[model samples]
Target: MIGVDWGTTSLRAYRIGASGPATDRLDRPGGILTVPQGGFPAALRDAIGPWLAAGETRVLLCGMVGSRQGWVEAPYLRCPAGPAEIAAATTAIPFAGAELRLIPGLTTEDEGGVPDVMRGEETKLVALAESLGTALACLPGTHSKWARLEDGRVTGFATHMTGETFAALSQHTILARTSVDGPDVPEAFSRGVDRARQPGGLLHHLFGARTLHLMGRLEQAETRSFLSGLLIGHEIVAAASGVTAVHLAGAAHLSALYAAALARNGIAVTQHDPDLVASGLRQIGRSLGWV
Candidate 1:
């Protein structure tokens, strides 16, 4: 079996063998943006062609590759969606002489309003949500998502454009002009979170960073760290306001940053391996009878 978790930035393909696991796996950088409809076949060939075997391998994929902007659009399967529902809703897109089965993203309504949509993380979050009762699973990334789980099933969720906001502010806004990357000062981040938590002071506190830098209170080397803290802190304070226990999944460092911001605010959260996405895919695949 060929398993893939193709996201907006990269693709990972694993060749599962008879020995109880997937092996001979290959990973390559190929995002939907880099490969439009006309370019996806070549992208797939470059990533998984070497592992293909006629009639012996079945490929399963999930993520932005299922989005409208992808090689082929896969519509969302509405909620109460277990593995079967997701499989039943799949759209098959042929690529590289192989049939690629894409899992549908999810759509559900919540108190936050509107039907929330999620790709990639749905597989991972659902797979790891077995911990029992109304879990608040926050997947941190460029488009961070905070979802609700009940009895090991996804009920609803909210997407905070926090990471994207940070990127925009740091790269395009004034914050970018003095911000530095890399982990230099943890103190500045802690301070940023502190500022965001103050009552009715979030918007007011934002300007303080620039003021500090200008007034020579904060060093240029620490500006980026502060900006990261500001954005992450604001997000944590906003998203985690009422939730208690939570699971954060994604890149380790990014998760840690969120962990720090939320933990400081008394919200308990733990980080997990992203490989759970594959596990979710496998479970969803089995439910779909593909296994």
Candidate 2:
């Protein structure tokens, strides 16, 4: 079976065996956003044509590819849903050589009743729930997610725009003037994390990135790392309030950063493979008797 995680900026296809890890995989920068109108079929063919030619008859996809902007809009399933619900909600798309299905996203509301949604991340949460049972999870990226799993079902979750906000502050705002791209600065990052634990809010804390630089207290190269720590620290303060441990998932670098911030908050961290989407897709496929 072929499992594809086609999101906005990247496409990852995994060739799964009857059991165990993926036998083969393909990675491409051609995400759904790059596919022109009526071009998804061609894009899929281009990426996994060889596997299909080899008689791979089943394909399951997850992520933004199922969004309204992707191939087909697989409507979201409400919170407190499990793999069974996700599998049952999978949306099928017409393809000649394979039975293709798109995993629907998940949605839940905050205390105030505003809705929160997640796409590709739900698959990972499903995989995590299968192993961890009941837990809190943090998936960090452009938009980070804080999800709660209870007995193999996602009870609720929240989104934080830390990465996106960091990008804007470090590249497009006045903060950019003092920031320079460089390797990670652990000291600066830790300092930022410490600052987040102080009394002032995020807005006031953000401006400190500049003032500290002007006062010759922060080096230009450290600005980026510091800003990242500050944002992630604030996110943890808000989202991880009562949790003592969190299952962290994402690219290695980002995961490490989040781990540090989380650790600073006295939270225990258990890192999970970023590619758990394959395991997730497999679980959903199993629920449908397609794996």
Candidate 3:
């Protein structure tokens, strides 16, 4: 079996073993955005050719691989969707003369008229929640999401685009010239978290990240960490303050960052192994009775 988590910037694949889990892992730079014309399997095979089994059963994928911008759009199932519902809607796209089972995404609207959509993270969030017997979860990402669940049913969620804002401000905004990578200074990050915990002034605090660097209180590298801490900590404080037991999802690197931000705010966080999406997808496939 082949499991894939294909997103905008990267594509990750795992070759499953007899234990019903991935054995050899592979990664490629080309993702859904990179394959605008759709050569997903060739790209993946090129990356994982050494581990290809004689008769690979199928490729189970989630994320932007099923977005409208992807190789194919697996239309989103509505509110209250489960693994079974997502699996039932899986569309098999032919690539490199192979069939790939694509998991559809989910969508719903909040009270504020904003639309929420999630792809790969949904499966992992559900699977991990079930594992921990957790009923409430917050998965941080380019667009961070807060999921509410119980007994495998996803009740509702809210999404905050904190990661995207950080990227935009650093790379595309005026701060790009000054921003640089630095260590995860706990003190600086904690300051950001405290700033975020307040009920108001996110806009002002956001500007402070830039101004602090200019005023010389923070070094160039620490400015980046400060900005990251400010936005991400603000997101955590706003999203997960009342909700206990947030399940930080996505790639390990991102989960670690969010975990730290949450910790700075005194919130208890649990980091799920990144494989639950595959397990959840496999579980979804088995529940759908896919052969």
TM-score-based ranking, best first?
2, 1, 3
Per-residue lDDT tens digits of candidate 3, residues 70-92? 77788877667666767777888
lDDT by residue (tens digit), candidate 1, 29-60: 87787886588777877777667744535788
TM values, all candidates: 0.88, 0.95, 0.82
Per-residue alpha-carbon lDDT of candidate 2 for residues 1-291, written as tens digits (9 for 90 to 100): 899999999999999866899988999999999999999999999999999999899999999999989999999999998999999989989998899999999999999999999999999999999999889999999899999999999999999998999888888999988778889999899999989989979999999999999999999999988998899999999999888999998999999999999898899999998879889888988888877
Which segments of model 1 are wrong by more than 4 Å? Answer: 17-21, 39-46, 94-99, 131-133
- lDDT per model vs. reference: 0.77, 0.92, 0.73
The predicted structure with the larger lDDT, 1 or 2, is 2
What is residue 145's positional error in candidate 1, in angstroms? 0.9
Please tell me which predicted candidate would have the highest lDDT against the true structure.
2
Q: Which runs of model 3 end up more than 4 angstroms from their true locations?
A: 17-20, 36-53, 94-100, 171-178, 210-221
Note the clash tally of each candidate.
1, 0, 0
For candidate 2, the C-alpha RMSD (Å) to the true structure equals 1.4
- Give the winner by lDDT: 2 or 3: 2
Q: After the best TM-score superposition of candidate 2, give how far the Cα of residue 266 lies from its true spot, in angstroms.
A: 0.9
